[model samples]
Target: MKVFKIVRVLFFISFFSFAQNEDYVKENYNKTETTITMRDGIKLFTVIYAPKDTSKEYPILLQRTPYSCQPYGEDAFRTKIAPNEFLMKEGNIVVYQDVRGRWMSEGVYDNMRAYIPNKKGKQIDEASDTYDSIDWLVKNIPNNNGNVGIWGISYPGFYATYSLLDSHPALKAVSPQASIGDFFFDDFHHNGAYLLSYWRVTPLFGHEKTQPTAKPWFNFPDLGTEDQYQFFLDAGPLSNLDAYYKEDNVFWQQLKDHPNYDDFWKSRGIIQHLKNVKPAVMFVGGFFDAEDLYGPFNSYQAVEKNSSNYNTIVFGPWSHGDWARNSERQSIGNVYFGDSISHTYQKNIETTFFNNFLKNNTQVTVKLPEAYMFDTGLNQWEQYEQWPPKNTEKKSYFLQNNQRLNTHAEKSFTFEEFVSDPKKPVPYSEDIKMVFTPRKYMTDDQRFAARRPDVLVFETPILTEDITMAGPILAKLKVSTTGTDADWVVKVIDVFPSDAADFPETQAYLKMDNYFMMVRSEVMRGRFRNSFSIPEAFIPNEKTAVSIKLQDVNHTFKKGHKIQVQVQSTWFPLIDLNPQTFVPNIFEAKATDFKKQTHRVYNDSSIEFTVLKKK
Candidate 1:
């Protein structure tokens, strides 16, 4: 009865305002702020907006973001328009809700996604809350047409995905934009490998628990947001961290709980349960999206293969958040596409997906699906029927004499050895930013790593013809480790012009840090490579074979350019200081736990990429 009353009151206001279909402005909408009580008595705060001129009820467009919910249509830190463009002009009731345990919302924020599973199955999640939230929104919100949609980027994107598992029937659309589907694959954990630098800096964003309570958290300038001052101050030899740790920092604890791909992570994975998906979905990602590239693609593939759901994917040469709005083309590390690719795409590509599905926008008739790629040189979007074209064939170039990547094999090759000491890891200066710093895996660069002695480089012969590679790149080689634990980093490089005046020669190369993270950063724990669930020690003098899966790449190595792969044992502080000991937790290792490890490259067991070609 209360819901009906709310609907009637809104209908009367909506009917009177429908007299004019004028251009919509920010203030022309009505908003309601509420601390909604869930079925479980959990109070989740939400900000709702409705089109003033609601002739017919509008579909509800919801975004569950931890980034906080501000007034709809107001200038947000994102600076992008909410109610998005298609929603604003086309008009829909937009709702932004803060997840439990963060901001003004109630309940312990589990960082929602990462949780160690219980042997007896005890766990609380965002999906249940999302269901509760949706149940209330559909029944309570006035002028809501039952149809609903949700979307977000990065951390918030994780919420969007979490909401879909046991979704409300009203949720007809959802776009998990650049979300990290598997925490271990990206984010805190990279390919089971630890992303220490990113982890070290992330807790700063969680409310003020990690802050100095005595000193207002706001007063202290944040590292990335403010300047480098805080970063240096926080990590300097004098900083004490216990004063900062908070309950909301579940992600930090999460790293400790799920040491392997056990039930803990398995329970959080929804890609496997993506059956009978009732919503029209849009999985958004950036072609160059470093952190969550695996998420969107992996999720899309799972949805496509696991279930017969209606879905679409849109990817441009973008970063973690760039896909959300129009902005500068380049992100960090001086990585730039030709121009403002985001602006050219913002004319309602994303908003259209939500509007067309949620509001049933008639303006959107035909839609595109599958992975879309934006060619760097061409500066255009191309739709692929599938990733790693089924028609393509595999081409392997072996690591040969010296640093030359060769189709021609070198029969006699000696073993190469280098000491991988975590304590004195490479610094993050010049081109070696990845060596010591943690960046949201997006930008691509190799100039700084091309000359590192620790990194063994291999190059393919100068090509008379162009080679087209459209698939996941893999590094298959004979590998061995002298110590209890070791890390092998591999990178794929696009050998461009060598500062020649002829063509302004410059090409992008994947560094060892990225390669290792992309391919097999999934933790081997060294002791568990033979099995993530089982434990075993490595044979010190044994030569073993390890295949590192380079993150997927789509490229047409143009003429005169070369393809190269670099191998190194340690990515250092960029990744955690892997103490060279295969202990339960390397964090507890002693100073003497560090050891220098050796690796070898051989002709019989050479480094090669499994390529796809037009078979």
Candidate 2:
């Protein structure tokens, strides 16, 4: 039921066949199944795939996942076992396990389970489970060199991060790719606003099974319509959706009860506990990853600040778990980046990372840089000595009159006004199809949004020189609303030149000219403007400062391209519509609480960015 399961299977079937055939995997590898007992006497089902040729001892590469370790029997073999074909063909004792309470593993499953520190005997957490598993692997698994490495994407990636803490001596390397650092900021919610687009995926983790099984026990809700925006709008308030989940869904009920960042959510956060990490860590994520952009960046920063363990980060122009695939051409939505981008990372970055630390006979002399980031605009890779390169300077672009984004603020006080109608919310994308959580919308064109009257668009003139931004973006706004509550959505866009040509991979109905490519965007529920734990209502018609932090960017605004900004109240079904009227819990807000409100953005509003200096 993991969110990445479908994409992983599709990628495995298509790419793995080309890289290494199923017959090759069945011929060279031997599969075995066993259950490892934890300190609490709970058994976790594990599958091990080791090379038949035992001439040389190999390192252990493990992936512990809430998603089931499929092809459960000893006779059945996976198409590709290792992280990539390079590692699979080269040979390693690849391991996959069903994390506690999931699949065939015996225990209770907790979403983003909190790390238990300084534990006594029989204390259980993901870290402890990982420790127990590694201990068992090295002792029982034959031909293992006593060196272990862990890697996973999405939910499994979170487990990889967990393994870093209280790690076994044999665990030398760890790669947490698109890992969830905190559910509050990751998949389910963004800045305290619930992501309604992800509603379809609730059944995956919400429902509990009577017993562990290899097949899915929860069923997805069938909306029976492709138009998600209309479906959510017709469904009305969040409370109405309870008809679908009801009391059977544990996670949905928990979400409704804890609308604020109280003890429940604070304890579940893993970022605060990423201290004294032992394993050599490599944090990987996509710049356009719609689901987990906040997780990897914040987790990496936490590790950098707390631990002295060898750590590095890599950001690519991928969406969600795209780096795990072996596609010849890499593209997100209407734009195509480069060919074999994921393959390059697998061969040069991922393969090199594991082999360097896990293999005793490795000849890898070149260590990865502190940061290996991809520039979306340039469509190229760049290495840095450190993240947010120390040479960067802070710059602010002000929202001016005549829809201009300038270096200076307006001389006089002026504001642009727009009426936000909850009944007619703005759609996040032009596409009308339903999705579990739309990934293409991250880099989707914004022409449809800009044309809307509710959305305010501000753009700077065509840049005479290339300007690159390397760090996080701060959207500091001076705004007010007639109603007591509202949600602020900010977007940073890259406007292509008028004469730009479409690439071969461009969408049939889309063009490259004047494409309003969304570089970054974030939303902040006004109620949580002051403190996440304490809800505050905005004074009607009073100008207040609301600052939203958009995720970090390693993008360059080319010489001919224009830097643009868009501000709006609603992002449609992407995020649940906030009732203009202030209410204690938005989850319980009735339909009558929703109201139309006129919002204003003053000219003094500005966006702050870390501008990388020209060297």
Candidate 3:
């Protein structure tokens, strides 16, 4: 009892120390507000926080965001800055800016503003805006060092990515943490399937502002009931959403305009323009991140293909921005990934990355491994010279008779069929409450989904050995649908033992017995099975190959735990329901376009996993 009391006291002391450090930094720093003008003559609002002690030169860490840098006045300071308390105590000049047309900034706001490659007079893009901002900072901000480093999460992360293109020479290091690479693949849509959960935040992006203001011009509507799934179902059809959003919402109108991966979305993608990146880049993402997983992974690949800069990636067992926020409690949903996993990353990887490049911390050289990824199955961090670790062997898990997953293919020429009804689409979660974002669903238990008649469940025998997957998971299916169009939802799950016991850290409400934890999942619209640019309808009863590339997963199916694969046609309120009819523009589809379809998955269909061999 004495030991327990002593340990509890020490824990609070340690936590207090970190909090005190953050408070001290805030007390010591001076906040100043200024406007930086872009080449197009639009002025952007910026907040600069410099330490009171000018004892030594500090590098500039700038972050540009469409999300307002609140506490507008010069006297008001942010309580915490620089990713975590570690970097804040390191004493760097932290700069935050409201990107053009956001908050106090002046100009017309554009969503994921397309980058203009060859600009004539008065033409501008996000890259040019970034260049101008950095140029202004170096000239105006009275800092000792010329070195500039930029980093951001989510949309701000998008700005960080854009800064890489035509990067300023002064911009030395950049970390696009959970960055959005493409609108079509990342946040809003995945392989042409719209994320219905994002509908809540659409008003935040869609509404136009008459002038730059501190508060939001338009507010997200309160979806009357707590049950969003039922609300969305009652709302009926994607076309009906416009009635609530109205025509004034430019972004809503834009979504209606471009139903396909047309030139508009193509030009907005930063991957194509990521050539010859000069900044020292470290792309960070989460293996379990529900949103923007496509960004960091694809951005890293694009950079590797285009540039030779000191580029690296770090994918932790985290949700969107979990590393920054939930530093002490390292868990997503019910899956506890050990304590201080996020703090370890912030102190060791992130802070070290910035200090090495920005502060020139000579104790450790800035040369890092190509990838520093967390293995969720093993609950350990692994560093590799290359991603998808070259030591992996490709293994295919074929769907066989009696809903089993085996290495050997079943040549019975049989298929599993289920009737998919749009009216009663399978809910993404069993939970009844509403949320702006369904982040926990990324790791939520799938036992509820497996019992659904419309979903196909396949599982491997309780693993005799620990099977670890290291890289991307590809699902290749030979399927036939009764309707002209459909959406394929694939889930990779880890089924706990029937007699499993909950860990001490597990949430009280979560039951460990027969737990089915989702590791990786993806949705692909059937029409885009051929091409995202063109919509192709499925011929009735004709077997077609539909390939779905699930996000990269670093997980282990522990010994005694079963590996389960769930295939379903609908994930309602999470992904927009497919009308299951040949509609050129799904955004404009009528309620009658929605229909019931029988989808068949052949026995020959299989999922390929990149399994890592144990050392």
Candidate 4:
């Protein structure tokens, strides 16, 4: 019996190679469903899949999305169609659409819409609906290749950064992963506060659909407790959670009618109109992207200071769209980060950034790095020709007199108190899980916020060699506040070495011995310090200077590890509690305007850090 016929021909060759990879897009694509139109005639709703291989021609890619581009009709295909799965098994036409008013599109949804600049007639936006959906998909699809490539992840990465503004000369290339450049500092405000963990994602962008649908018009709001910090501290203030969203959420009434940074958040800030940009951009994100890390580092430094074009940026050790997932041990919660880092960023940097600009006789020459990043305390992937890498060194530290963090300063002036208690605030996470915006508290373990006495810890002493740091952290608070509005937060930590070894992906009642990790953190809103369009309040005790910034980070601190620096003032419910009184609207405060006050920090409170210089 010839060994049962060679195990029945190796189980019929592994069941026909798992049915040709689960019906490779219904065995080599062809799924249509159109609409397109745009430039104000509206339409949108697309879908396409193409590729039946009429011997060649392909490249289209696109994405758009307001989330739903579901498996709707036209023989419902999509068990994965591009943007990974190695660009959905190479051979693109792909497309998805449904943007303008979202789902089956027709126009009306505006959250983050504002980008018009020189549009004549029907004044459309998302860069003229991505330049009229890449001019009707390179003039009506088919086995074509007029070349176009756009990607998305997170609000379709903000419409792949609005197709690099007024673009579409066959679009060329764009990435924008984990993007959202600014809903006031990337995803529901940061420097001006208010991110109660993105308040149940405001009914999927403040509901209001009436037609053209395939489903999910918007629902998520049954917050009846999973202890989301005692359901947002018993829903106190934020106008008692606006009765779980009253007047049918139009972006939660434009977040209670623009809580500042006016011009309705500087006209939906697409990174100050990412100037002259025209395709060939990358800008992916996640340095623990607890929601857009201020939109891919201010949209890759606003297209590297107003685009020369072919700009780039990667940043890994992901969290929000973990490099558009495929997963194989690339952890983030208990920190594991390696092994197929999102399938080596989809076979070497997103299929060589869309096969070196939408393949047409392509061999993919791969020359990326304008900053790839991902150190997260040395986990790996680095490369940079520029990106806070002008051989750094800004340094600063300070906050001294016992609890040190030195680099010298604090000759005499000393202060250090804390009280803060907006009814006992300060728990950004010890697994507060009710997440929508938590992302493992972006590399958590701050020793439960440095044993919170309303946090203010500040160490340094042990690291004798490896420090690294690399870019953007400012902080600079010489404070005082007996309640007149406050929020501060600023983290940074690294600590580790108490014989640190717990990684089997840690967390089993944790133990990386002296772990404290949390590489970077932010949250400002001390009445927007001087102005996020005029906020100024803390005059109660007056030391006032403030500053904050805190976003970029490459991280190393290794030698014996220590670095620290906590400083806090209620990061509870992750922003939105700062009612130390000043009210023109702390989203309509008044629970006795949240009292408990005290707060101080001076010792010439410093911080700065760009460091990185040992080549």
Candidate 5:
């Protein structure tokens, strides 16, 4: 045991050291700082790390981000540059830039800046900014091959996607990993429902800086207690947040102004503009990504539909940005996957992708699959010729009386009733502590929620055979609410066998005994069932059909594992509490709007799973 522990420690030490060694980056590359002027005469701060070898020219890899390109001075060096250490070793001229109006850049910052299709005079947007930046880098930067590639993880990923639109001639390849294509469906809002958990970042992007500074002008509110469920509940209606945010926060004000998806959000969506993509594009996302899952999937689909570009997608069983940062891809929270899964992806997929396009390396002949995804249940990587592979068949599981899920529809009319109270909303996870971003809740055990009177649980008989589900999940629910307005939260979970044992690595913190792991879930504002642009009231007790589209899932329920569905009106703190009463603007809803109401989900309702039938 002692010898094993020593070997394990040494393995990780060696793994990370080789992957992200600060000494290695500095020794091989020379760092230079420059301020590149945009089309509108706005100067943006940028950092360039060029290979010391003057014998050969290297391709320029750029990442534009709202997040600061830190270690400002030319003398100071970042811990590492490029997405992986292999790229640094391959000797590329990597660049990092602070977008206009952010961190030493002279301009104004617009949150998810609306793309300007037709620009006259000195007009500029993220796409134009990218063009100007790329054009400047290839021309001015020393010892740079004309070829350029752009990539970034989260917000930076958004910028990378923007680059694909009206791409520069020099831009050869681009990867947008966990990038948000639309704000309404991606980050702050999911299907027109506000993600209350992200309210913590109100100060991060909300505040307007008078000058280009290295540090954030504002600080996040320090919640006295770690229990966000209690904290948000005590705060009352969503309007209560105005007390802290005030009027100066433009982004928060925009949320209030745009109660419904309208021209404002439509203009900000980058997916529609992904037409005529010139560069070879790779869209990356995590299946369990709490944030921005909609972005990568939708962006890839849009490109595939509209543009004739070489596009592919990669999704792993990882949390937001986990594939890029985590060395231990073996598990997320209590769930244990195979070891070095992330390392394998980085070494095999990401590195090879860049080398083929940017470096023009013909030796790397590996053709990446069109859809390279990790099956969560099988815990292995699978490649498909097309996403939502042509082989899948749509299967419907009907919700029945007595907490049951069956393939056949129930002939008799029956319903499960739950009283939803805004004051005492359902907690998203069993854990009491507040997470700034509720990530683990994506795969959290649903036992606590199953026991809740307000949450309705429906389950299938233990699967006799492995049921593999791929692609999108649709929840067509026939629901009626006593109140005029409400929010419908649907969760698809995998129930572990009763005799299941915990893995050795997670024995201390996890127990698999009848564990209910959430596979895919989504929320829909009841008012927006018909249309997101306009909201309609429920008309009290009238039955309404709400179609809630859960994000794409590639999970398999192994034999003996039961597939479960959980339905609830409120997923508090994770999503802002719906007042229950109809309000034109939920952000401006009054305290009186918060009330207890009974919600009924009929047996006729069904969940559609894209099942991959075995040969």
Candidate 6:
């Protein structure tokens, strides 16, 4: 029997002794500050925090940020040190520097996407700037133990990843939280789907257009932070994304140049270069994180598989901003965690990883295993040697009942036919406020959407026993749209409680990729559903089989939560409106080109879900 003691939800974790000790390091004024010039002749603004009594040497913790390195910020009010903490203020020195092209740093700020690296006969990159910055910090900073480590969240997180590239030996550990791997795949290009709305919105949202010329840049409404947004009504470079900004944007042009996985995407691709990691690092991500779930997870997996370096992965049920700002206890809707788990994981787990490797010179694997995940259904955290558990069996459930799926015994039924209008795509919700968001309803009451003539819904009856599934989910459907090209958005939803009487609290939605969504896995352009690397026009009304793969999904269907699978021809606003007319590039297709089309799903061994379930 295991005897586990309860840990209070609230507790303090002081990083370094000096931060708490007033006499050790004066938290008041500039203990030390300077701007160092890199070997490339670009000046980097740097600030150094040192102990008041510098009679002895201490380990250094380094952070490189593009978000302006404010020399004297509110962070001073907090103590940096405590035993079992990351910012053990007592260490050698803490360093912060502004990345090139940001803040006071010299060099024209070319967004990271325009990274010009000095590869063999290739353009030079910010990687060298990172290399140069670290090199200068180590040699110049005083009261230094000479040991250094780097860390940053989000964009700075990107800088943190590059710090190790052509890195110095003295560099120790790093933690990249919600960091982006490649702008193409994870950021604007989700599963190869051109996230046009988010892409254009992000640049403006981040004030990227202001660049080096627009000094004292202003912050606008974050894309999703606004109270309400009429995306088309807003007048700006971003509002007319498909019109004014489509091919004109520099990065957009670059992305188009590399359509269909080519050298362009491969250049900034960090996965291949992860080998020979100099620092013991930790990549953090939220399972529900919309921004960069793939960044930390993929980064961790790539490094572990491609190289001999050891790293750790921490995955929790969190959205983009959940892990930090919200109550670590729980967040949005009715999803309440039993405890302040986020708090513990953030302070203890994150700080521990940094301090242990950078300061203590200890191994990270000993304290906790390489991978740790919190399971929502069980309300507990579990440790595993690897992801997708070693012993996972693949399973499948067929689509029937006029596209209805049920465990209460189901039988094959005739295929369904519906006419889809490109102009009036089925909105995901009944309310007009969310008309642009057509996919949200896929997670909600399938009943409302199934009534639509254009949608196909397959549902399973309430389960008698919990059906546990772990790993990615896939949908192999034999589908044919009347038009030459169209989009198909699939969603796997968990219907905890039926809407017949009351709404259930527990629910999760996983959106599938259009052929565009499949770039992360596979692509099924409507013209080539039954074929590959070639285009095949829909024989007007000919029936064909096409496999649609929903990305891997993990969930356990408790005795009550019904499993729902929804299929639609369009996921507007989330995806560009398919013109329903085969064209060279739908992004530029004229309005007149769009047409009303009839789509038919075949049933002769046509549609099935390769789902995983318990024996």
Question: Cα RMSD to native, each candidate?
Answer: 8.5, 2.0, 5.7, 21.4, 4.9, 8.6
Name the runs in model 1 displaced over 4 angstroms: 1-25, 71-80, 113-124, 202-251, 328-332, 361-364, 408-414, 427-445, 499-528, 604-615
Question: TM-score ranking from best to worst?
Answer: 2, 5, 3, 1, 6, 4
Q: TM-scores for all candidates?
A: 0.80, 0.97, 0.95, 0.38, 0.96, 0.76
lDDT of 4: 0.80
lDDT of each: 0.57, 0.90, 0.85, 0.80, 0.86, 0.54
List model 1 lDDT by residue over 437-474, tens digit each. Answer: 33433333454555666667777767687676666666
Which is superior by TM-score, 3 or 6?
3
2 or 6: which has the higher lDDT? 2
Backbone clash pairs in model 2 (N, Cα, C under 3 Å; residues 3+ apart or in different chains), count: 0
RMSD of 2: 2.0
Q: Is candidate 4 or candidate 5 better by TM-score?
A: 5
Per-residue alpha-carbon lDDT of candidate 3 for residues 152-255, written as tens digits (9 for 90 to 100): 98888899999998888889889998899999998889999998888877876888787878776776666689899999999988888877788888888888
Comparing candidate 1 with candidate 5, which one achieves the higher lDDT? 5
Indicate the worst ten consecutive residues by lDDT in candidate 1: 10-19
- Candidate topping lDDT: 2
RMSD of 6: 8.6
lDDT by residue for model 2 (146-237), tens: 99999988888889988988889989999999998988889889999999987887877887876778777777777889999999999999
Q: Tell me the deviation in Å of residue 604 in model 6.
A: 6.8
Q: State which candidate, 3 or 6, has the greater lDDT.
A: 3
Candidate 5's C-alpha runs over 4 A off are: 1-18, 361-364, 504-510
Task: Give the TM-score (vs. native) of candidate 2.
Answer: 0.97
Model 5 score (lDDT): 0.86
List the candidate 6 regions with Cα displacement exceeding 4 Å: 1-33, 49-59, 70-94, 114-123, 199-202, 205-249, 252-262, 326-328, 406-414, 427-451, 498-554, 603-615
Residue-wise C-alpha lDDT for candidate 5, range 284-352, written one tens digit per residue = 999888988999999999999988877889999888777765455466667877777777888889988
Cand. 1 Cα-lDDT: 0.57
Give the per-residue Cα lDDT of candidate 2 at 178.
91
